[model samples]
Target: MEHRIRLAGPAEAAPELACLRVIARLPSHWSVEILECGTGYAILGLRTRVPAEEAVARIDEAIAVLPLLGWRRD
Candidate 1:
């Protein structure tokens, strides 16, 4: 399933994003940075898992779309 990721720009928003839940089947996930509350905006990245046979194609689609999800780890 495709997951939608949203950014929380405030410290208060952290709890919501920091504690985001995902299905167990999805790969391990975590944020590069725990953005300071009420300080900066966070960029979020999202993609759905696909079967090996379909991965390449889906990757292309993911690439075509803006990686609204954050690309940097640091």
Candidate 2:
């Protein structure tokens, strides 16, 4: 299955850089990639074999720390 997280409003960095930073903080076991990026938002694609609900929960938990980095879900 594939899940997506949209990160927006990167404070001092380009969208790609901000996404990279977020990816770096996520668990290495996760299969994550940058799907799309623009001036203020980046879309991260996560590919996993887990169930849908669990995948959502995992992604949510992973992104919980994004607010501290000046990014918010869009």
Candidate 3:
């Protein structure tokens, strides 16, 4: 299954850096990538075979710390 999260922030190197940060927080079995980046938002694509609820929980947990890195959900 695939899930997407939109992070609102500067569109510069911040997006790539944020992607790395998120990747570090997720389980190794999951695949993550940047799907789109705009002036003030970035879309991250997460792919995993985990159940929907578990996936959402893991994603939320990973992103919960994003604010400290200067990002917020969009």
Candidate 4:
């Protein structure tokens, strides 16, 4: 098997950038927890020979931040 790597700037990452925005205007007193929010990035820094447990933990953490997982717009 083989793989390829690609790089992109914020503009290329978001075509019609303004249209794809998801705003989470949380209240002042409540907690502000969101995954795809500003400057709150999740880096799954997995090396070539890392342990499964470590990778799983990192992935879980990233998944936990996603607010749309249990949400529906229908």
TM-score per candidate, in order? 0.22, 0.69, 0.71, 0.27
Maximum-TM-score candidate: 3
Candidate 2 residue spans exceeding 4 A from truth:
10-12, 50-68
Candidate 2 residue lDDT tens string, 1-74 = 87887878755658887777777766688799999998778899988777767765655565577443566766
lDDT of 1 by residue, 1-74 (tens): 33333333334333324323211223455222223323333433444454443433432333233322332122
lDDT of 4 at 39: 25
TM-score of 1: 0.22
**lDDT score for candidate 2 against the true structure:** 0.73
Candidate 1 clash pair list: 10-38, 11-37, 11-38, 44-69, 44-70, 45-69, 45-70
Summing lDDT over every window of 10 consecutive residues in candidate 1, give the lowest-scoring window: 65-74
lDDT of each: 0.33, 0.73, 0.73, 0.27
Backbone clashes counted, model 3: 0
- Model 2 residue 34 CA deviation (Å) reads 0.6
Candidate 4, backbone clash total: 0
What's the true lDDT of residue 9 in model 3?
Answer: 64
Q: Candidate 4: minimum summed lDDT over ten consecutive residues — where? A: 1-10
Off by over 4 Å in 4: 1-47, 71-74
What digit string (tens of lDDT, one per residue) describes model 3 on residues 5-68?
Answer: 7877655546666667777888998888889876767788888998767866765676678443
Error of 1 at 17 (Å): 10
Model 3: lDDT to the true structure:
0.73
